[model samples]
Target: MFPERLKFPRRPRVRRRLGLGFVLGLWFGFLFYRPVAGLRPLREMGRAWGDERLFVRKDDDGVSSLSEWNVTGTYKGAWGFLDTTNNSSRFPDFKKSNGNSVIELVSTPTKIKGVHYVQGVIIFHDVFDNERTVGGAQIRVEGVYIWPFRQLRMVASSGKGGEFSQEDDYILSNPYHLLGVFSSQVFQESPRDKIWRRKNSPVLYDVEKHCNIEFAAQISRVSSNQNDGERDNYHLEGLMESPSVEEDGDCFSPLLLNATSLNIEVYYNKAVNYTLMVTFVSFLQVLLLIRQMEHSNTQSGAAKVSIIMIGQQAIMDAYLCLLHLTAGILVESLFNAFATASFFKFVVFSIFEMRYLLAIWKASRPMNNGEGWETMRRELSVLYSRFYGILLGGILLMYEFHNYIRPILLLLYSFWIPQIITNVVRDSRKPLHPHYILGITVTRLAVPLYVFGCPSNFMRIEPDKNWCICLGIFIGLQASILLLQHYLGSRWFIPRQILPEKYSYYRRLDQNSNHATDCVICMTAIDLTQRPSDCMVTPCDHFFHSGCLQRWMDIKMECPTCRRPLPPA
Candidate 1:
């Protein structure tokens, strides 16, 4: 018999909830609250992109225009201007200019098959007011294209002295080429002036089309006090490079092609949708897992440990949902790109994956040395889980040093799910319920599909259609399995049955028996005279209430007092 002092401790109540609440509160507070000025909540800071406007002015003409110039660049294959700084150094000669303002322009022309083809321009501007007292300065120019296309033709001077025509013939011919025009900026000493702009006309598509593009930066600066007739003189100098013509068939560099052709909107939309889907699915799974855990009996050590693991996973999933929601909001808000959020999300996911693997390792211990196929299956799980778990964790750690590790990590993560699910199914002694099977299968398939389909890294090609088709097949298979299981009226989830012969073997105590004899399962006295059928005596001579014994047996086929194994149903 088990010693009375060796009684199992009752599970703590509200502990998991308290931990979950604490974690969630910390996360919300970090993302939504700030103690420092200028450090607004993520949600509010994100609005700067939409509300901030750029004012550009041409110094000579004093013509000013308003433009929304968002940061644009490629991040993990997605295009947008988020978390990117636009700052360039001043030219050597222009550094001595009045306000330490310098603008350098370079133009390159490409010739293909003895024909002049494309022209590209790169402009670098740097301005600084050393005198702190100088209120502000402005730079403005006319006839500058805001969103210049790949193909551009400079208009000839309209017989005016040192002045080119404000209108270009190519602008009218290619109406779509004009995305916007450059406005003026009234710079303050507090925020120094810096601008880096690159524009290239599209070269011909044929690789045989040897094309070159040339560009130049034209800028003028006027101080805020210039209108007061103060003795302030601005100097303008132009430096032009001799055009180099190439006969080679290199139409354009691959990097240049990608930068010009990329459609930011498409990738941005895909990211938002993908994050939303992950959040929804993760939330649903958390709810379902919690329900399953609550219904589970935790009398056995393994069951108790599994319950704790599930609770941890559910909490992690809830956090993941929050992260995804926050990331989606920031990306959509145009305040920040997905880079920062994606990194944090990846870290959290890596930690969660490690914990999950640990749980699986613990759960598989009992079957590791068992006889027959169970032993082989358990060994397989242990080997793969250990190998991949170590590899994945190492890769995540190494990713900080090298970005190329991301693709490999994603590939491994995709396959890890299926391997885990296979082990789970193999480890189960009884057939899994259809709902359980469906959930596992869908999650395994969906994660890989989402990982591979989403823009997680830089790639020259889009997602393959074949992979998408395979993903759809997996989804269909899950639905079919659910339908088939339901049609067959599977008894997978039914409670264990107690044979009449087994119950009849338990003898009921009489009224003369000691009133202090209590059932081990419920700690209640076995009052046989009050209700004879409700009391039972175990084969070990220990007594218990019938209902208590039945409930105990439902969790494990063992005697509550002696802990002896009972006959299997």
Candidate 2:
């Protein structure tokens, strides 16, 4: 009942339009305009930092030109911190530089009469930028072929990317030649140049007269991707240093050495050793399997063998884990070790190891009671879940202190340890299962061996090689046993059922042929006309695909028809 004029509601169109306009302005200011503004300084910085030299001239248009620079003698090791060091102190008078954009080599050594040589592009980075971050040009090596021939051909290199240049022959007899060319027109020019923030934009280095060494490598093997002659495999930076101006060589420039390249050959060796170790362990696992199967059937000769193998396997597993954990510590490039060595991490790992040991000990007791094992499992599970929740929560909340990543890793290890223990313990409960026994035994042994080799630095204690070797042998024995049991299944004591060869492949029966309509055992529908390889019919008349039945039968021996055990062949 207020005055009609006062009761009328105001419209929001003007306010909505104003709000939209503000949002649009913000988007342009922050997202679009700001980035463009930053790029302006970035380009200027690139051009100002390096030389704009002309190396080649075909005509007045300057259609073909190359920039040249060199670094002779050892400049301040830190002066050209971002350039590759292959050309640094390693090569005297190393001159390496590249045009701002992509360049093409029109002729190779074969095209002109001369000695064969390698030619590759080199991009330069600013010294200040190099000191601040990891910066270097990407050198993509095209495949090297014989030079000093009539005509020459080049193609893009290949590996993950596809190969190029399938044509093989060279041109008629002539001189070996190599010509380099760059475009006169710039891909990026002023007026149309985009600007961006220095920090946000990629920092490019355009060096002047000084030689910039970006990377240095001490290689026992040269050109891992190529199998060319030894000359192509020179120690390092030979090409960057030797070229002259008449031959289109940039002057020697400073080379910067950053981090050292990893020894790839060492890694390859490690992989081989690791694989051999795995095979040996697998063999032992198989042996344990056979012993378990033998014991289940006769229970006469397998007890001692089983016990010994289990012990050996445990020792081996623990030792291997320790080796890896210790290696992780030794490699200090990453801060993970310091984090893992924290008090929290130590405590968590200790708790996890203790829980696993307890489970094993409880299971191995003379008393056949399983209550202790179950109790320990429950306790470990609760602690594991609780700690994990806390760790995850802390990390998610960004409350993960600098000190906590390591603790989390240890706690994570705990989760897996229990799982490993559970798998062995649960499976071993079957008594005659060799695979389960071997796994359990190995896990138990691994713990002590790991502890013995503790503090991997060998400062405290070192595992005897003889003992380790013995453990390896024992693991191999267990692996062999498992392989045998895998063939035997649960009824290793009972002779296995073997169907007629005719039933191996699935086949459809002819409508007129006298054939059983259902599986002999289960009475299930079976298409007789289908090949035996494709379908299988049990003795009770249940029909199924051979693959499906084979897989199912591996786990179950009884026929679907009568729940009767499969007949011994």
Candidate 3:
């Protein structure tokens, strides 16, 4: 049928190979080459724009290189647009030069004393490629480090392809001496270089729009291979600026002057405030825990507390600690920023909340009802499955719906709801002290508010006014409901019309019949002739002196005679 498509797979296999090749070719082309607008081959890429080669000056400053200073490490910075995009008169033509690539300089030393070879990859986008449609280019660069002037003189050569993915062909692309020493301005007038788009096969933007551009930057040493001074735990401040470099008729690379450098430092300072805020919140938790201990017996009194709410708080602390700890260990630069904050969180969670959580778990356990072991095991398995399942499912949900993080936070903070229901369900009275409720609510809001409300947050997250206001209102409302439950009775909010009738222990008993019964606790005759408050009645119709039963319920909630469960006062 259908011309015997593969012909039973003959021994020659030529037809099979041809068919497989056709399928694979289509798949590869679909996966790798995504042709979009403004993409063309080299010739159509306008005139091959930029600098012509000139002689490099190697006559050195004649000053000896510092023994400890080695320009052999990585430096990260960004190509800037800055005030230019405001339609500034000075660089009006720069409106098109909007695409930027994050520059990472990997340097190594050579046999020559003050000379360090540098290779840079222009990843994500470059200055020239205007379309920004397809933006990846690699530049193999070598620049002489001028220690006297603190500059990378640009007598540079260009090589293509990616990082060391291929064999060490860097040797072939040499005269390694022909690194970044520009006869133009690179080592000359202002230390700026006009990068050329000609000698390279265009990697960004199918090739057509070859807009020549200039790149001006300043290099500073903030850290080193040899670091000392303040003993700081390793934590990196992840600061990001706009990595966009644009292209027009002429590319205008931003000349980073003193103002730009000052701005960068200012941004870094803001991150310090973030870490400080975290430390402050951790200390607040300590104070809150101490206050709670004085008010209630957490192990036994926590029976009425919502275990989910407490465990949710612990989970939040654990995640925060793990995140900061992992970041500190992986990146040396991050150690100072994340390490101390993580330690504080670890101490607060491990020593403080973990113990609280275990106590809550034990106190909140379901009472045994003489069920078989298999039934209990199945129930526990289901319970554990729901917990870890929510943990994993939440990660995927946040990834898929990250825009709805505010709503997620709202849901997270609704942990108080379980306690409110538990109070009504069990008809318990004053399970949590008022001080604990108020303290926990306020402390929990610290991290979320700093992240979403503060404009100067280190994470560079944009502040959301509407979301912040809504979150505050939502949390306040929850607190208000809990406070109402504390003062106005758990069932006070329920309409009287719908409330089920409850048994009353204070109704006047049969006067003539009960006047003769003796109160066991006080070893006195019952004062039944007095008001209803003077006599207490148990559901079992047993009588006790009112003052005696009140004091006994303080230690244990049980009827003295039958030892049966007693309702809360």
Candidate 4:
């Protein structure tokens, strides 16, 4: 908030020119030079060019096996198991490659740590103590979430292409088996191991819709071949994803590219477009205000201008409406955009300013105050200097740096909406002059709603932008008008009378003559009236003392003699 004593900055004549020149240069560079150069390399790197498949492992050798897969897609893989025993034992194999997963979450409870990338082979045991270890399987995998309580229970189905039934499936001897299996097969092909790893080897299976496959090593265990520990459970370790990992010839990088590009296209683009629309609407609004003030109109002329002004306002209102409706999309992406947040501020502040003007007008009415006027002055000063200051300033800052405070703004809106509704209900009760109410009702309420309801309104933009400038202009106008009104009210005389005849008896008195007279209102003799000049006459052809007349006017604008009210002229 600016201090009460703030003076508008007086920029040097050349400052504006320099600012415009700089902006033009920057935009020109962005549009012509940098944009093309930045995208040129991307063009040559054909969209279809990508790495083949990925691996899931956890050591130096296994890590290398998964590196090529990381070049094309991004994932986080984890291996955890649920054993079908009296107590149902579970183990989490923490081997990893591409440590960061596609789904990122920071949560409570260890089991729900979500997916992570890995490459490895494992064995599975049947109820008869027959162990099967699958080998030479190229693995590209991530975390396997087991609903702790539903570890053995079939949680859900992928609905892709699979089925399970109790009829013929009752012959299934391996009822104590794992589902929701993770493997590198989805991203890779042609395992170097031939005897076990084949496309139609029945490795991949669907149980209740989940795509899963038994590791090649698991089958070996069923054959009872005691394999080496390292060979028995293979694993690999790799990179943890971070911003520094710029796009490269990798699977993960390409997926990242798609996500990043989509976000920019949806959010930033809408912001810029909304900002432009706001500028245009603000320009039109300012123009309309100027025209309304300067143009005197007959019914026909007013109709014509009203049509044009209403059209422009309608367009702006429509865009504002759309911005409100799509707030989830725009705000979720980037909170602080001028279009998404500050534009609403513009609408709100504009309404407040209009009300402020009306309040000032009411305060300035001749019948409303005397010493009571100072109370109003204090009220207005406090209202504008603090509450309005904080509101408008916060809005301006929000518009400029919306992304940083988007979350805070969303929270604020929850509170602000109710407060606004309450205030609207309270302030709608003034006995407004007919003309004023008609004008305000038409301009403020009717037009905004109509505009928003219109689909093709001219002010339509992804986010509303015109709000900040519009709000500033409104505040400025209100303050200026209030100051001017104060000046005029103090200077202008409505209807007043000055009585000279009431002091006629003391006209002859002078320092040399040493004469005196009686007070006209009280008719009290006093030697102090060397020349009674405090008398005032009314237009009613009656005379009264200055003090008497001031008191009389305070109570009633009527003559003491005939009791006729003083003419407003």
lDDT of each: 0.36, 0.34, 0.53, 0.31
User: In candidate 3, what residue range of length 10 has the lowest lDDT sum?
Assistant: 177-186
lDDT of 3 by residue, 304-360 (tens): 667777667766776678766764554344468768889889888778876665556
Off by over 4 Å in 2: 1-109, 117-137, 141-233, 238-253, 256-281, 292-569
Model 2 / residue 9 / CA error / Å? 99
Best by TM-score: 3
Q: Report how far off residue 188 is in candidate 2 (Å).
A: 28
Instruction: Judging by lDDT, tell me the better candidate of 2 and 4.
Output: 2
Whole-model lDDT, candidate 2? 0.34
Across 478-545, the per-residue lDDT of candidate 4 in tens digits comes to 33332332344311222335311222212332333343445455775445343355545456445456
Ranking by TM-score: 3, 1, 4, 2
The lowest-lDDT stretch of 10 consecutive residues in candidate 4 is 175-184
TM-score of predicted structure 2:
0.23
Pairwise TM-score winner, candidates 1 and 4: 1
Clashing residue pair totals per candidate (backbone < 3 A): 36, 112, 38, 56
Question: What's the TM-score of every candidate structure?
Answer: 0.34, 0.23, 0.56, 0.24
Q: Where does model 4 exceed 4 Å of error?
A: 1-263, 293-364, 369-373, 379-569
